[model samples]
Target: MRVLIVDDSKAIFMMVSQMLEEKGHVGIWAEDGVKAVEYLQENSDVDVILLDWNMPNMNGPEFLEKNLTDSFTKTPIIMMTTENKPDYIKKALSLGAVEYIMKPFTNDILFNKFELVDEIA
Candidate 1:
């Protein structure tokens, strides 16, 4: 699986990338939603997106809203963020996110979410 990780923190990206790599998956980093969009425009092979709610230039919700009409809309998105509020999760789902993962998650949690995404997709 090729996962597009949209997060502002390099550390988070590194950690997640390592976790994905352990499972023989590739991780692509995008510092923010703007960059993610740009990357998607050129690469439609992304299997899923692990999006952060807060970021510079563009946020996860903004990205989801913007991509609603784009070709990559078919790509499943999992909102990975510190925002644990039910409202936030609901909003993300309403906007088009297929799943949600709170920050500070373990590798198991991340991969389990991926499995769920796979089932859904």
Candidate 2:
């Protein structure tokens, strides 16, 4: 599986990439949503994408908007964010996120998300 992680924090990206690697999935990184969009323009076939809520240049929601409407890539997105507010989750899902996870998530949750990704694939 090809996983793209978009987060401003280098630490978060590294951790998530390592976790996905342990699960035997190839992972890629982008510092912000704008970078992620650019990467997608050149590369399709991304199996799953986990994006952080806050980022420079373009935020997660902004990316979702552009990705959903401006491009042909309809990659499934999992919102990995520190924002735990219910309204935020609702808004994200409404905007095209497959799921919204709070920042301090566990491997179990990650596995569940992957299972769904598998189903989608």
Candidate 3:
């Protein structure tokens, strides 16, 4: 799968990209929501989005709200963040996030989440 990873942290991008590669998926990254939007505009083959909740310039929820329309609305977004509050998860889901994964995740956890998402998609 071609996955778009949107996060501000360079380390997060590196780690996630490595994990995705290990699982035989191509992972493209964006430092913030603005760049992510640019990438989306240029590429229409993204299968999933691994989004970080907190970022400079534009946050994950803001990005989803702004971009998840028309064709992009059907794209799956799995939020990767430190926010674990029920309300925060609720808000993300309400705003169109398909799944949520807490930060500092392991390879197995991420892989499992991706597998679960496959069923839903």
Q: Which candidate is the best by lDDT?
A: 1
List clashing residue pairs in candidate 1. none
Error of 3 at 50 (Å): 0.4
Residue-level lDDT of model 1, residues 1-121, one tens digit each, is: 8999999999999999999999899999999999998998888889999999999999988999898876555789999888889999999999999999999999999989989999998
* Candidate 2 per-residue lDDT over residues 78-118, each given as its tens digit: 99888888989998988889887888777789879878866
Q: Candidate 3 on 12-119: residue-level lDDT in tens?
A: 999999988987889898999989888887788889999999999999989878865634446789998897999999989898888999999999998898888999
Which stretches of model 1 miss by more than 4 angstroms? none
**Clashes in each model (backbone N, CA, C under 3 Å)?**
0, 0, 0
Q: Candidate 1 or 2, higher lDDT?
A: 1
TM-score of structure candidate 1: 0.95
The superposed Cα distance between candidate 2 and the true structure at residue 106, in angstroms, equals 1.9
Ten contiguous residues with the weakest lDDT in model 1: 65-74
Please say which candidate is ahead in lDDT: 2 or 3.
3
lDDT of 1 at 5: 94
In model 3, residue pairs whose N, Cα or C atoms come closer than 3 Å (at least 3 residues apart or on different chains), thus clashing, are none
What do the candidate models score in CA lDDT, each in turn?
0.92, 0.86, 0.88
